[model samples]
Target: MMKKWLIVIVFSLVALFLAACSDDGDKASGGKSDGDTVNLDFWVFGSTGYQELVDEYMEENPNVKITINEGEMNDMHNNLFTSISAGSGAPDIAQIEVSQVEKFLQAKDQFHNLNDYGAEDVAENFLDWKWAQAQTVDGEFQIGLPTDIGPTTMFYRIDVIEAAGLPTDREELAAEIDTWEAYYEAAKKVKEETGKYMTDTPQLVYNAIRDQQDLQYFNEDDELIMEDTVKEAYDFTTKMIEEDLIGQNELWTPEWGTAMAEGTYATMPGAPGWMVANVKGNAPDASGNWDIASIPEGAGNWGGSFLTVPKESEYPQEAYDFISWLTAPEQQLRSFEIAGLFPSTPDVYENEEFLATTDEYFNGAPTAQIFAEAAKSVKTVYMGVNYAIVDTEISTALVNVAVDGADPQAEWDAAIERITSQLERQ
Candidate 1:
């Protein structure tokens, strides 16, 4: 009877230990057991070429599943804000545009600090500037991983420029219009000779020039500082509008597509690598007639995005692991090949495959090499939380001057006043 009781006690103890181990395993996997599936919801705006990657990831890790929600950039951002305010309904992971990231940083508690899941170990994988952009001002918290970068360059129509009696070779044209002043002079010649506007809009010219500055609307300390470059860009754009050297077509409009197809504009400066897709998609008939050159004198970044794990995520570790893998150098290069979204990983910039990339749409221009050099030249600038707000006001003022015939100085003054008032309210 004693031996039988000992055996039974041993069996009971073993069962309890096994049950405890199973519970611990489930907790570690965010309440899912090893054999159970882990599902993640991902939100993003625009085509990031992530669906293919997500499919691959699921195949490799059959225990995990991911669903992606694609929406327009503005609508998705607004929806995210609403979800965050509701304290529920947020996706496990979200993609935030570079300009808008600063705004989200203001509500940092809503995001998981990626450093908690070994993000610091992969910091060297991305460009220094891009990596810094997602971190807190004190560098204590990181909200996301860099996905893509926008390095500006001059995308021009080969035949339109040649028709203006200008050099068509990339190097020759780059040298001829090496300065903004020189660029404006060439614009005049293009208008006078070819009767085509130099660019689609004066606002684009202002954007390119304004972004090139080492300082923008705000400093690292979050102080509003409008540098001389901003005024210069404003004046330059207004001068183009006055001279009738720019087209009235707003970007993304049907008229803008017509203008590009008909060669109404000769060139678009400060265009990012991703613009290659827009040009190809909008003006398929004009293939081989277009080419890319370096932006005048220097380069600037225009657009990019980061992937973040929201604090509401039940599986933060899984979300981090997936994003880290998705944004790795290899995947980023693949994204470039698939979507023309330039990689933020500098290591990918030197990859032989990346270096050899050329576009038949741009007359086989060494598109990759040109953009890589431009990306290297871009300076690190701090975009404050109010950067986008300030930029919108300034852009609105520019339109008032260019379209409504508002006085340049009066509009500038009013914009400054409005930006100050808005910032104070926020």
Candidate 2:
């Protein structure tokens, strides 16, 4: 990014020199006049397909030129954090993942509050939970505009379920596993008929149930709610593990791919679109064997992102203009069309094209509508600044019990202690 900026500066200087060297009338000689170009430095992370979008935006607005630097999500976030702390070298705008967004809330003042630029007026355009995630209590000091949302839906292996003598129909299977209890019973039947497990691992099931709850680890006031909701979620996860319904494989690993390809699991409880894509990508040989369904209980989200303008940006208004346009309903729809990033905008849900789209990977299933309905139905969760850390602590507790034969009660007590200790330090 620095090198690109230096080159732009040199090019501007050469343009000034050429103008000055030209023989003109008594009019103002060639020296660079006031620069009108809004050169914005944008850092995008992950497979957002923003490069093409930025090219389109630049072509439409010749006066504005944006330089996009892309990298992995973790790298981009680390760089942004360093720059923010150093008070220099930050990009005009950057992408932040939902899980990591809470970390920035502690330094909220470092961002250009989108609310100051009239972002609240279009709040209805986005899904309520996504919009709420980036704002303060009064909707003041909103630091980001919602982009792609990850609404949870079930993905299952049709062949595996059929092999277990379960209904192969999507709606019928949906009814069969409409609740966690039903899902476990179905798992038992599947295991009895065939040696395959019901799902990948206990942690995912734990997370799926935890995400759906109104309060998982913390309340809106940042009070810990472990004893009430978290304990129950853990207990359910432990029961599944104890019953041997879950396979002992890590997500997104070679073992996971092999399991999918071999039809070792009958169902995935609820997953984001990208995670479902991950499943499909890893097991392409199993094409036409997998499909999506409604989440057993209801909707929950596991992934998404925000586009934020930093306070250090010299072109704040122009940057905001670019992000607002990028995250707007029309552009979000384009993104989904290009990259499978489910739109956060509810208005796009009514688009006939989106509703009618089907996936061959799921045997021409109407996954588009499935995801859109789940997107709107998601409950709003007010995660505190300590969410990532606290959630990880609890997740580790589940892992300990599953892998080490640790007592569930003991693990739960340890998780609470870790969360309280870590959050207090934060």
Q: Which pairs clash (backbone N, Cα, C closer than 3 Å) in model 2?
A: 19-30
RMSD of each: 3.0, 8.0
Across 96-136, the per-residue lDDT of candidate 2 in tens digits comes to 88887877877888888888777888888888889988887
| lDDT of model number 2 | 0.84
List per-prediction Cα lDDT, in the order shown: 0.89, 0.84
Best by TM-score: 1
TM-score of each: 0.93, 0.90
TM-score of 1: 0.93
Error of 2 at 111 (Å): 0.8
lDDT of 1 at 290: 94
Q: Report the C-alpha displacement of residue 227, candidate 1, in angstroms.
A: 5.0
lDDT of 1 by residue, 182-212 (tens): 9999999999998889998777899999879
Off by over 4 Å in 1: 1-31
Q: Residue 140 in model 2: shift from native, Å?
A: 1.1
Regions of candidate 2 where Cα sits further than 4 Å from its true position: 1-35
